[model samples]
Target: MESVSKIRLWILQEGRSIRSVARATGLSRNTIKKYLKDDNPPSYQRQAPPARHKLCDGFDTRLQELFEQDQKRPRRERRTAVRLYEQLVSEGYTGSYSPVQRFVRDLKRTDAGSGEAFIPLHFAAGDALQFDWSEERVVLGGVEQKVKVAHFRLCHSRKPFVVAYPGESQEMVLDAFVRALSFYGGVPRRVIIDNPKTMVTYVSRSKDRVFHPRFLALMNHYVMEPVACTPASGWEKGQVENQVQFLRGRLFVPMPAFDDLDGLNDWLRLPCEELANRAHPEYSARTIAEVFEDERAELRPLGRAFDGYVEKTVRVRSTCLVQYASNRYSVPSRFAGQHVSLRAYAGRIVLVSGQDVIAEHKRRFTRNVSYFEPWHYVPLLDRKPGALRNGAPFVDWQLPDGSLSSAMPR
Candidate 1:
């Protein structure tokens, strides 16, 4: 091609004769003249050979069938590409593994879900808020544990609030809502969330949703509509999804260390405020915090905060302890063999008998631990002083002075 172009250029542009070009280029006069007569450069076209069947030519149907059949089997029991290749080889397949690998790759690409279409969502001031939970690993109290972070974002202002929890239980969800509402200083008209079991108990095929009874009460109290996204469809609330990713990368990537969940949440306050104060991506002139100030006027005035706790009734054992989350908490001996209402808060547990608060203890995350208030068993110990020598509840008892300890026998 280069030689042809050179010959054409020399004859047409340089005003050189074809014979002179042929003499200098060592080409036959006939070839040089042929190129010179035509203004276009010399071109070569190679015709493709006739197609022929290869050893793996008809394997597409077979692979599709095999994959469809394997779909009915458990995930761990399904066949891999290599295993399929071996089976094909045993069945008289004469092709190399490369073709099979390419076929499998193409099949997976074709079978993947189609690209999703996203609509640009617009929100009025304080119209809606998105809520979600994201998991992160962090060192708390010198121990590494996976923590669930609750994320809330106001759609219009892009204002965000985040808090860490020990788990994603119903109690944590409600507690997060209370904290977020308080932080935002008001409640949005609607709360958007995924179809978590704690909130949405069921969704019919027609998209009719049934929320948990307690969650319904919460919605009623807040005077906000509860909007649940379709099951497995997270993009319905895309704002909070993006916020979760932003927080994981910006805040939790280094795996922040704190002495407790409270400390971690307190540390998050400054970052969250900074995020709000940053310039809004869409509203170039105003920051999120400034925009939120306008949205605040649109929000509903929040009434007294809800007592966000999960309540259950448990029978007090003869040990004068009520079991909650596989751990025992001591109550007054008078409540023994009686049913008491156990209210579980994010940071503490409160036990109530009838209308009186009988006991309160710091919430424990670990299992098989017992919390005892020595005062709860004092009356029983006074009645049966002999049992005090080796009571399970008194195992770690210590007297303020050395005199009382010396009077008791070991």
Candidate 2:
């Protein structure tokens, strides 16, 4: 192109003769004349592709069909290139696996959704919040375990709050909201979440969700709308989804060690606060904390927490205890033969009968261990004086002063 441009400029613009242009440019007059006649620049032509082998005759079409079918199935159930190759071999295709593998790879790269672009999302202050759960490994009480960390991010301010729970149960989801809302000092107009069974019971064909009743109740109490993301759409809550990775690197890395979940949570709080001191991701001039203050003012004022609990009705056994989750918890001795509502919260279990709370015990996560309140058996002692000798609840009971000897059977 450079030579052609110079030649044309010398002849057409500068009025140089074709013979002089060819002589000066070290090209034959014939080549220079051809260059002048053709208006388009010279371009290289690619070699024609070699013909495909006989075995690939119907293989490309079959591969396309298999890939299209896999796209409709669940991601985990999708066939790999090797699996597709195996299926093709079973069907009597004599071609090597390389061609089949290449075709699948090419199809994936050119799929309709693969090459598409997404519009950048913008949020008004207090407009929405994104919630997600992440699994992080930490040392707690000398044991290395994975903790479920609930992450909450305000869409506008990008301020984040996280709390670790033993597991991601329905009650833990509620408790996380309580903690996050308290940290932000207000509630956003709507919350965006994934379609987890804990939050969403059903997602209709049109994306309408039948949110879990208790979860819906909490939203109703706060006058907030709950938004469920499409089944596999992590981009809907992309802020929190990204936060989970960012925070795992920033906070959980180096493996923080704490004696209890509370201590770990307390340690997590300082980092979260310090993060706000950094420059905001979008508005670099202002710190996240500064922007958070502005967004906080736009937020709805924080109200009383929802009394979130998973309630179950169970009949107390003969031993003055009720069972939940394969474990026994003592209710009041009087309710041993009666039915009571067991309200399970994130941290405690409360047994309620009618308007009365008969017994409350710290919730336990372990299995098969019975939790007992020694005082619940005091009334039974009067009728069964010999009970203290062999009762499981009294085994570790600490009697006051000399009361053990005085109360013993004489």
Candidate 3:
């Protein structure tokens, strides 16, 4: 690997004889003589550095700023990475996706560590139990309906509970949590969850999650901390996620049909409780119940029963009845034309006008024409008798003479 200049100087100054050059340079005699007349250098100088691309010129700072902004806002309007990418593109960023994706990936990795800042509980010592719902299908009265299965698994015991309900609304979600807490005989210090709109209203980029006010109020009532998982990492709540599939197969595979939600819920509870008490299939000495017993002491005792509150707003109609899920409910005549909040319980509907109980009725199971009492709808008939023509009270308004003109002007 001698320099070309050095080789040439050696050849010119030390006598260009091939044998003499080879002896002086320590190169093979034939090699030294061949290079003495050759004109070009070796061809190994073409290696170069990789190309540079900027997917996010200033996104790290922007992402940090966005996360800070989200802290003061509701979860429903938080900025997502996908949303941020669109924003970046609009700002005339000329970078390709790889860089953007890479930056986001790193950002999320850091956020994951920050988001998991939970006070770890000891195994078998009442560690935080998390509850959630995953979409499932079950047959109700011979019809297959889409539903969300309520799922709860003790972090320490890994003892899981599941119940299927018709929808993912707030009432159903909260109902499931109450039942799970009751079955466990206590509430964990913290209940972890994924961001369902029912519970979490927003997620901050700092990984702070904003819970719905009513939901947070429920947590406060139960004396348990509510921890929400990072939005995209479904794996953060993997125990319940795994139990969802397990329960789906073990409980719902045969697709048991039932008369109603109560019947189905009643039936689903037994086997799940049995499964929890039974010895672990793989672990000989431990049962789910055994592990959960240890977790119970770490949990906070239930405060006042949730009162099974299902908060909903309904406007009073002209008929003095509030429409709820395609069904009509009667309020007192005094509440007509005013907006009211309805608290639907298992057996009653409590209509509250700003902390004042305006009206309450036994909740009706049937969807069509459910009435609280004769008096509730009597005012409607009194105001407009014709309104009862297609109502449940239509026959009650008939005159003994079998004439429609009994009370009409003759």
Candidate 4:
């Protein structure tokens, strides 16, 4: 393509006729004449598409496989084009990503059939906080257990909090959130969470979000808005991404050690807080604490305390104990004959009698036995001494198997 200026120069300075300029430049004779008369130039292309790949082969098969994998896996777990290309190269593919990615993306369009393109978003300060969990195995005193850490992040400050917990239950999530709030000194105006059953009930009819009752209650108490991120977009809440790495590298490195979580948490609280206060190298001019203060002031104060947590209705087995989690909890002997609602929290359980709690016990964990007012098991102990020994591993029956003593049960 020739510029209008070049054509006009040829016509005026070089004395080329309009018809001749048109043949040379591939413009209409009239167009060439007009440009020469007006001295106006048309835009010319500066560049063309880059050269095509000569090395790439089997492009169709590769694209089909990539698209099939993307369809099979959740978006969060799907292999990115870069990763796919890397894997392909390892498997004797010499192709670069441009054509392969272009083809793979096109395949997505067909597979989607909805014409909706995946769009990137910009997050604003105080707008959203993303939540997720990561598991870390820590060996403390030769005992190794895989610990799940609840992670939270503030999008604006990029500040994050993480705490180790046993499971991803509602109670653990609530405790983690409260601690995170305290760590950040405020909550984001809106929290963007994944579809963890702890907070989300069912996917809404409109494919919106349905939050669990307890989760909804916490949101109401805090007066902050709740926003559930799309089902598979983990990057939606990426503030915790850096934090998860930071925590695992800094705190969990060389492996963490503690006799119990309570002791570990006590040691962990201060160091984590200090990490939050430390100045970020990227934004060395200000600390996360400084940025967080602004967000903290904007958050609404928490209202009424959360109604104590409890698991769903569980039955008392033939052994006359209500089973919560894997550990068996006992109510009073009188209530043993009847079913009861077992209210459980992070550290405690209460057996509710009507509106009142008839009995409460500090919740016991795995391989541990808990007994309430031991009189409840006297009849069973008398009936079967061997069963009593098996049932109460941590207790002493104070009687031989052949003889039933009238000793008071401790």
Worst 10 residues of 3 by lDDT: 115-124
| Candidate 1: pairs in clash | none
What C-alpha RMSD separates each model from the true structure?
13.8, 11.5, 17.1, 9.7
Clash count in backbone of candidate 3: 4
* Model 1: residues with Cα > 4 Å off, grouped in runs: 1-115, 401-410
lDDT of 1 by residue, 303-375 (tens): 9998889999999999998898989899988889999999999889999888999999999998988889876
Q: Over the stretch 211-311, how does candidate 2's per-residue lDDT look in tens digits?
A: 99999988998889998888887988899998887787567655789999999999899888998998998999999999999999999988888988999
Q: RMSD of model 3, in Å?
A: 17.1
Better of 1 and 3 by TM-score: 1
Which prediction has more favorable lDDT, 2 or 4?
Answer: 2
lDDT for each residue of candidate 4 in 156-232, tens digit (9 for 90 to 100): 66666667777777787887777777666555678877788888988966778778988888887777788887777
Q: Which order, best to worst by TM-score?
A: 2, 1, 4, 3
> In model 3, what is the error at residue 16, expressed in angstroms?
62
> Of the candidates numbered 1 and 2, which has the greater TM-score value?
2
List the candidates' TM-scores in order. Answer: 0.70, 0.72, 0.61, 0.61
Model 2 clashes, total count = 0
For residues 93-125, could you state the per-residue lDDT of candidate 3 as single tens digits? 666666666666676687666554434334455
Q: Candidate 3: where are CA atoms >4 Å away?
A: 1-124, 281-283, 310-313, 345-348, 353-358, 361-373, 380-410
Backbone clashes for every candidate come to 0, 0, 4, 0
The Cα RMSD of model 1 versus the native structure comes to 13.8
- Score candidate 1 by TM-score against the native: 0.70
